[model samples]
Target: MSVFTLTKEHLDVLEEKKLKSNLKLIEKIIRNDDFYSMDQKDMQYFLRVADVLYRYGKAIISDKEYDDKEIWYKENHPESHLYDVVQSDLRESGKTVKLPKKMLSTDKAYSKKEIEKWLDRILNTALNLNIDRDEIIIRVTPKLDGYAAYDDGSTLYTRGDGVNGQDITRAFKRGLKVTKSGKRGLGAGEIVINKKYFDKNLSEYFENSRNIQAAIIAEKNVDDKVKKAINDGACVFYPFSLIDNWTGHYKELLNDFDNIIEKIWNAVDYDVDGVILEAVDSQIKDNLGSTRKFHRWQIAFKRNDEAAEVEVVSVTPQTSRTGRVTPVAELVPTRISGATISRATVHHYKMVKSTGVGPGALLQVVRSGLVIPKIEKVIKPVEPQIPEYCPSCQSHLIWESDHLVCPNKSDCPAQTENTLVHFFKTLGNNDGFGPKNIEKLANLGVKHIHQVYDLKSHQFAMYGFGEKTSKNLYDQLQASQNIEIEDWRFLSAFGVSRLGGGNCEKLLQHYSLDNLFGASVEDIEKLDGFAKVSAEAIVEGLANIREEFFKVYNLGFNLSITPKLSEQQDSSSPIAGAIIVFTGTMLQGKRGDMEKHAKSLGAKVAKSVTGKTTYLVAGTKVGENKINGAKENGVKVLSEQEYLDLIAQ
Candidate 1:
C-alpha cells in the first residue's frame, strides 16, 4: 500500500504550470522504498512533486523524508536552479509588490569552529576601524520556522524572492494578530501558529504546522476552524525585533553559547528550527554587508536530529596515506536524516574494540549538517573484529595510541592511491583525477603526483583510458599548472602533518614558501597559535616531503606568494601598529581600497570590534548602536574625515 494518499484535486492545485509526475509511479517509488537505487531523473521528479505537495498542505511523505530527498538532490545536483531561488508556496497569480526591504536568508554554521571563523571576520573588521573588539555586542534569537513575511502597518506581504512579495494583507484582515500585542511596521517577521494551540486544536486536521500556515494564507476561503484559531490569537505575526533574545559581549556569548542557545531556543511558543546570531553593533553590520544570498553579519545555527539504529553487516579496515588504519562498519541499509546510510566510520580500531562494533552489532547513527551519518553508539555489542594485518599490504599492524597503524607507508597500494586522490582533490583547480581514475593509474604503476603530471595523452591511452579521456586528462594536467593557486594551498595539497591550508597560510605569512622547509621547530613554535608539539610535527613532515615537493614545485604551477608579517610591522606610517576597524559605507573611497590604504599605512585592519582596537572609523550611514557599542568598550569613534585628518597629523 502507498504510505500516504494524495487526491487528484490536491495535485491539480499545486501543479499550476510546473511539471506533473505520474501518481502511480510516485506511489510505486515510495512503496519500493529504494530511493538510493532510483535514477537521478526519477529522484528529481519525485522531489519536485513532494516539495510542491508539502507546501500546499497535501504531503504524501513525512517532513523528514522530504528533507532527506531534498538533501540528496542538492548533493547530487548542486548546480540545479532549485538552490538559487527561494522555495515559496505562493502561486504566481498575485499582485507582486516590492517589499519594504530585502529579506535575505540567514547564513548558516553548524559547528563552533565555523562560528569562531565568523567572529574572526568581525574582529578583523573592528581592527580596520580601530574599534575595540570587546566593544562588539552580539545578539541571539530563535529562528522561527514559519512563513516569512513583512509588516508595514498598512500592508503585510509574503517573502517571495526576498525583494518582491505578494500582498498577503488579507492575513491581517482575517483577524491574525501580532505577537505580544506588537505595534505594526516592524519590517520583517514570520507568521507562526502557537505549538500548544496546534497540538490541541489543529493536529488531527493538518499534517504539520507548515500545512496550517499555508492554509492561513491561502487565497481560497479560509476554513472556519483556522479563522477561529487566528481570531483567538493562536496564529500571529512575530516580528524579529520583538522576539525573545539574549544580548551580551561576543566573548561572553561564546563562553556560554550552548547554554544561551538552549535558553532562547525554548523561549518562544512557535516552531523554531535554529538560533540566529548577529552583531548588535550597527557599524559592524554595515561593514560586513549582505552577500547576494545572505547577510555576512548574521548566521543561523541549525541542529539536525535525524537518527536511526541499524545492525552492522561487517567491519572493514582501510589504510590512509598517513599509515593510520580506519575501521568502516558496513551496515544493513538504514535511512537517517534524508539519505540511506549503508556505512559509517568507527573512528579507529580502539573504538571497534571498546564499543564492540562488529558483525550483528546494533549501532545508532545521527546525521548532522552535511557530514556523513556517524555512529553515535553501539546499541547491542558483539565480538569486536580487529584486523591484525593491513588490508592493502598485508603488513602486521601496530597500535599507536588508540589507533591501528601500518608501518608500510611507502609500498602500500591503498596509501599511495589515497595520497594521489588527496592531491587532485586539494588542487581543486582541475578535475578528471578522481578516486577511480587515480586507483586505475596507481595499479598501472603510476604512483606519484609528479609522475601523473609527466604523462602524455598517448601514454594515458596505453593505460586503458579512451583517446577522448586521455586528451582531456592531459589538458586538465596543463590547466592545473596554468591556474593560479595560493602557494599555501599548493603546500597543503602535499598533506603534511599539522600543516593544512590554514596553518600553511599562517606560516607563509611569516616566511615565504621556499623558506618554510628550512625553518626550525623553534621558528614555527614562536608564531602565535602554534604549540611546540605541532611545530615539531610540522618540521618533520616538511622534511619528509621536501624532495618530492621541489620536484612538483619546479614543474611551473602559478602560485601567489603570501605577504610577510614583518614587512607590515616595519612600516613607519602615522597609524603604524594601530588596530583599526572601518564600518558603514565609506564616502571617500571603496572599502577594499581603504583597507589596502590602511594596511599600507601600517595599521592592522580588522573586520569587527575588539578590546585592542584604537579607533572606530565611522563612515556615512553608520548606525548609532555601533557607535554606542564602540564607546561602551572604550574605543574612540572617528568619522571618515576625522580619520583622514588624524592620519595627516
Candidate 2:
C-alpha cells in the first residue's frame, strides 16, 4: 500500500547517498503526486533522487512523471543549479579518465511550436553565415533508450559527467559485438539489447532489458544468460554512425515532420524514447556550440501525451494511395498541449462499427507522441456511420481484415493522384507536383509517373494550364531530371511496396541499381534484415511496376550511385578507414565539398576533433586552442596543403 515498497530496491542502491534524510518527504510527494506545493529544495532533491534511480535502472517513477516534475521545477526556479552541470550515472569504483570525445545530452522539445522555434534559430544562424536556407540539412535518428557508452576502439567509456568516465571495456571482453558486426572506433553510441530477442529469450528471467544491461557491466561474474545474449549478438554496442537515419533539407523535414519522426522512431529494433534532430552542416554545428548539458544544434522531440474529451461532429472517409479507406473523426475544435485539435483518426471501419464512432459520439482524443491526433477511446456510443463506397471513386468497398479497402485501385482518382504526389514528394528535389496540380494532371489523363515526365510545355498548355504555369511545369520536370539525387532515393520514388528509402539503400549497398531487376526473391531473402515474406512482396511489387520503372529510370535523370560495401572495404584510397576532421575556412574550395571528397575516398569525416581521429586537417584561420586540443588527444595535425600532398601520394 505504501509507495516506498515499490522503490525499496532503488533506496537500497542509494544507501550511501545523502538523499535518505528526505525519504519521508519523498514518500509524501510520491503519494500525493503533487509538484507545485513543494518548496524549491524539496523539489530539487526529489528530482535528483528520481534521476539517480532512473540511471540505475530501478526507476521509482515513469519517465513521463519525472519529466512533468522536471518541467515544473524549471518553470518555478529558472536559476536552479540542476541546470548548470551534467549528472553522472556511473557508480563503479574505477578511477575516471578523460573521454575521447564529449558526450552531451540532447535538449528536448515537447511540441511542434517548440520545434518550430528551434528551426527559426537554425534559419537565423544559417542566414548570418551566408548559407542558403535550402542548403541547410537536417539529420534525424532514433534516441535509443539504453546505457550510453563511447567506444574509441581501444577502450570503451561510460558518459560520466560528460567530460570524464570510467572504463567499461570489460563489456566488449565478454563478447558483446557491435551492431551489424560494425567495426570498432565509431565513437559515441549506446549498449542496447534487441527487443525481440529479450522478449523471446530473457524476459522470464530478467525484469527488463535494463536489468540485463546492468548485469553485463557489473563488476562481477556475468550471468550465463546475459553472456549467451551477447554471444548471440542480440545484445550489442550500437554506434550512432551505424544506426538508421533520415537526412534531408530542412524544408522537407518540416513538411513531413510526423511521417519522418514516426519512420525514424521505428527504424530500429531497440527501444526508443524519442527522435533526435540535428543540423548536419558542420559550419552550423560549429557556430551553434553546446551548453553544459546539451548541444544547441540538436534536440530530442519527446511525446507529451496530453489528452482531451470532445464530441464528434461526423466521420469522414479518405482514400490513400494504397487504396485503403481511412475513417477520420471530425470533432468540435478543442485545444490540447497548446495546439487546437479539430479531428483525429479512428483505426479503421472495424473500430468505427465496434465502437460506434459517428456524429454526436463522445470520444477521448490524444495527441499521440505530441504530434498526431488520435482517437484514444469512445466515451459514448452512437450508431456508427460506415461508408459503403470509396470516397474518391464510387466503387464498392470491402472489408480486408480490419480495414475497408477500395478494390478499384486502377481507376480511383484519389489513389492515382496520391501516387503521383508521393513520387514527387519522395524525390524531395522538386516542388511543382502538389496535390492540386497532380489532380489537374490526373483529370487530363496523366496516370503513370512516366506520363507526367513525358509532358512537354505545349502538352501542359493543352492540359489547360496557363502559359507561364505550363512553362514552369515543363521546366520543373526537366529540373527534376537534371538535379542529381541518390540512386536509392530514385528507386524509392517508384513507391513499390516494402521498398522504402532505407530498404532501397540496404539493397543498393550490396547490389547495383541495374542488377536489382535481375535479383530473385531467394537472393533478396538471403540478405540480412529481409525475410522471405518481405522478399516475395518486394518481388511481386517490382514485377507490377517493372515496365513503368524502366520508363522512368531511362529518363536521363542524374543519380549518384551508392557505393558497394564490399568495394568500400577493399578500397585502396590513401585515407581509407581513417577518421578525419576538417577545421577552419578552406581556400582550396568550399568546406562541404572537401568533406564530401574525403568521404568518397573511403574516409570517415567527423564534425569535431576527437581522440580517435587519425588526422585533423587545419585550414586558414585555424584556432590555436583547437589545434592544441587535437595534439593533446594525440591526433596528427595536417595543414591543408600537406594533407592534400599525402593523399595525392
Candidate 3:
C-alpha cells in the first residue's frame, strides 16, 4: 500500500542488480521510516535494499546500522542472512582478492553479557591451547564511523565488502592526508574528517562528509571544497594503529569501562560510534579462527542506539524558556524499530544553515541513546528554509548564529507549555503529567511544577482532561511528592544545561542540594568530572532555578542524601586499597564484575591476575600451574567467596 514494498517487483529489481534505483527507493523508505514498519515481506524488502545499497556507495543507513539491523532481523526470523549474500552480488563486489591478510568484520556485542561470552570463549581457548590467561592482552580502539579502506603501499582500496575493491589510489592523488603521520600503508584503515572542522568550514557547501568521501573516489572531477579540505589536512586516511587507544588485560577493561570509553571517545576529533575491542594474541587468533563474515576473537562493542533518516516536511518554529526559537522538523511518517516516527528537532537555526537541513532534505536522525537522535548528517541538499516568525506565538524570530530565538519568552505559549512538561519529566517520580496532560494543564494557566502540584480535584476537569484522567493526574502529583527521590535526580528534572543524571549525582556527592544554590563555579569545578565550563553554567543555571528548586525542596518529599566525599574517604579501608588483577578463567565467579566490586572497596583491581597482583583470585577454569606460579611469586590466591568475605570484612 505504501510507495515501496518488497514485492516480486522489488525482488526482480534486486535480482536484476539495479543499484541506483534500489538505493533511491530504499532511501525513500528509510527516510520515511516505512521500511521498519512493514510486514515480514516488506521488512525483507527494505533490508535487502539496504544491504545492496551498502555494498554500493549509496548506503541507506550506516554499515553499523546495516549489520545491526541484519543481526536483529536474523535473531527474529533466523532465515534472514540466508538471503543475505547472493553469489551474484559477490561478483559485483569484484574478484575475491585475498585480503593482504584476510580482514574480517569484528564480531559484535550489544551488552556486557555478550562481552562475558567473548571472554568465556577466550578462556576455553586458553584451556585448550595450554596458554596462560595472564599473558593474554586485550586492546580496544574507537571504531571510526567513516568509510572503510585498505592501503598496501601503492594502492588505496575500498574495504570492498570486506575484501576485494576497486583501486581508489586517486583519493590520495586528490591530496587526502594520513591522520597523525600515518604513512603510505600499514594495511587497513578508514577515511574520515574532523567533525568540529566540518561543522565550521565545509558544512554549508557539502550536505554530509560522506558526499565528500564519495566525490574523492568518484570517476568525475572533485569538488573545490573537497580539494581544499584535503589540502588543509582536515580530512585524512587514518590507519587503526595510528589512532589513540586503551590497552590492558580483560579484567582491567571490564573494571574500568566507563572511564576507558570516555577517554577513547575523546581520543580523536572525528566521529566515533563505538569501541573496537580485540584480543592481542596470535595463538588465540589462530585457535578461535573466524567465520565467513567476522572473526571470533575480535569484537566491536557498539551501543544499541536508535536512529532514523527523515525528510524535513516542514520546519515549524517553537519558542523556548530562554526565548530561543527551536525548529521542529515534521517528517513524513515513518517507523524505526517498532515506533512510528513523525517529528524530530534541530539544535538551532545556525545548525539548520551550516548543516544544509531544509525542506525536502534527507537528514540522518541518530537518537542519543533512548533520547531523540538529532540531525547528525544532512544527506541530500535542498534550498534553505528560514522561518520568519515563531509558529506558535506568532512573534517575529531573529537569529543568534545557529539558533533563532523568540524575544517573547515572557509569554510564549509553547515555552510555557514545554517548561511545564519538562518539570514532570525531570521529577520522574509520578507519570500522569506527561506531555498530553501537561499541555492541557498549561492551557488552563498552570505554568510551573508548583502550580501543577498545588492543583485540586476540580482543577483537572478545568483543564479539559476527563474526570478519571484528572483525578489520576492529581494523585500522580501527590505520589511524586511522596516518593523517595535523590537530590540530584530532583535537580536534573529541571534539565539545566550540563547538569544531567551523572553530573547531578557527582554534584550531590560533593554538596547537598541545599548548598548547591550558593556554590560558586570554583567550588563546583573542584569536584571530579565537573569541568570549568560546565561548573560555570551549572552555577549560573542553579541560581536561575533557585526559586523553583527551593519551592520543591521545601515540599519535604523523602530524599536520599548522597554520601559525601568526606564520608566515602572515611569508609575507604587500606585492606581494600590493593590493586588486584585476575588471571586464568575463574570457575566460580565472573571475572569482570569481580574486578569492579574489588575497585568499589578502594582497591585498584586489575586484569591478568599476576605476580604483583595483591590477590590472584582463582576460579574453576584457572590452571593449577598458573596459580602455583602466582603463589611462588608471593601473590595471594583467594577463593571466590573468600575474596568476597575479605572485602566484607
Best by TM-score: 1
TM-score of each: 0.52, 0.48, 0.44
Q: What's the lDDT of the predicted structure labeled candidate 2?
A: 0.79
Worst 10 residues of 1 by lDDT: 83-92
Instruction: Write one digit per residue (lDDT tens) for candidate 2, span 1-649.
Output: 1123435676776684545766777665554333443445567777777777777777765565666567646753444556432153345556889898889878888777889999999999999999999898999999999999999999999887766788999999999889987998899999999999999999999877888887888788999999999989899999999989999998898899999999999999998989999999999987777655678899999874668998999988887666677787788988765556777667678999999999999998765322345566789989998999888988777665577766553456767665687689889878888867987889878898889998899999998999999999999999999988888889887766667776897899899877798899999999999998678767765666677788888989899887777755455788998999999988898776787678778888776765578999999999775787687567899999998997898
The C-alpha stretches of model 2 lying farther than 4 A from their native spots are: 1-5, 16-18, 83-90, 304-649
RMSD of 3: 18.8
lDDT of 3 at 500: 64
Q: After best superposition, candidate 2 residue 363: deviation in angstroms?
A: 12
Query: What lDDT does candidate 2 reach at residue 79?
Result: 41
lDDT of 1 by residue, 48-166 (tens): 66656655656565544455556545654443545333254334466788787878878777678779999899889888878898799989999998989999989998887666789
Candidates sorted on lDDT, descending: 2, 1, 3
> Which one wins by TM-score: 1 or 3?
1
Best by lDDT: 2
Question: Which segments of candidate 1 are over 4 A away from where they belong?
Answer: 1-145, 157-170, 173-175, 179-183, 186-189, 194-205, 218-234, 239-447, 459-489, 505-523, 526-528, 543-547, 556-569, 573-649
What is the Cα-based lDDT of residue 278 in candidate 1?
89
lDDT of 1: 0.77
lDDT of the structure predicted as candidate 3: 0.67
